[model samples]
Target: MLIAKVYITLKKGILDPQGKAVKGALYSLGYEEVKEVRVGKYIELTFEDGDLSLLKDKVDEMCKKILTNPIIEDYTFEIVEG
Candidate 1:
């Protein structure tokens, strides 16, 4: 079997309101040492073992088509054998 681990995050230079909210909450809780905060999404997909290159292409397509926004978000994925 193969597992695809996908990580999605906002591109740099884009405003992240959710991250800012989390940081503000942390500060309210007295965590002043935190300089910045960024929130991201993690996704795991399981599939039957197959052609590595083809699977990679499919996963990339999936990310581009549905998993992440091409204009504001960036995504990276790794395939692991299980």
Candidate 2:
């Protein structure tokens, strides 16, 4: 079996509204030590076969097509054998 882990995040020039809101709320609650915050998505997928290359391609395609918006987000993934 294989496991695929994917991470999705906003692009460098894009603003993360949710993250900013959380940071602001933290500061309001007296958490002044928090400098910055960014929110992202994590996905885990399992495949029956231990094919590293094919699994990687499948995960990458899934991220590009469904997991993230190509214009505003960036993604990376890793595949491991189980």
Query: Which tens-of-lDDT digit does each residue in 3-76 have in candidate 1?
Result: 99999999998999999999999999999999989899999999998999999999999999999999999989
Alpha carbon deviation, residue 46, candidate 1 (Å)? 0.8
**Each prediction's TM-score against the native?**
0.88, 0.83
What C-alpha root-mean-square deviation, in Å, does candidate 2 show against the real structure?
A: 1.6
Model 2 residue 38 distance off true place after TM-score fit, in angstroms: 0.9
Candidate 2 per-residue lDDT, tens place, 1-82, comes to 7888888899987899999999999999999999888899988888898667777777888998988999999998888776
In order, the Cα lDDT scores of the candidates are 0.96, 0.87
Instruction: Give the candidate number with the greatest TM-score.
Output: 1
Clashing pairs in 1: none
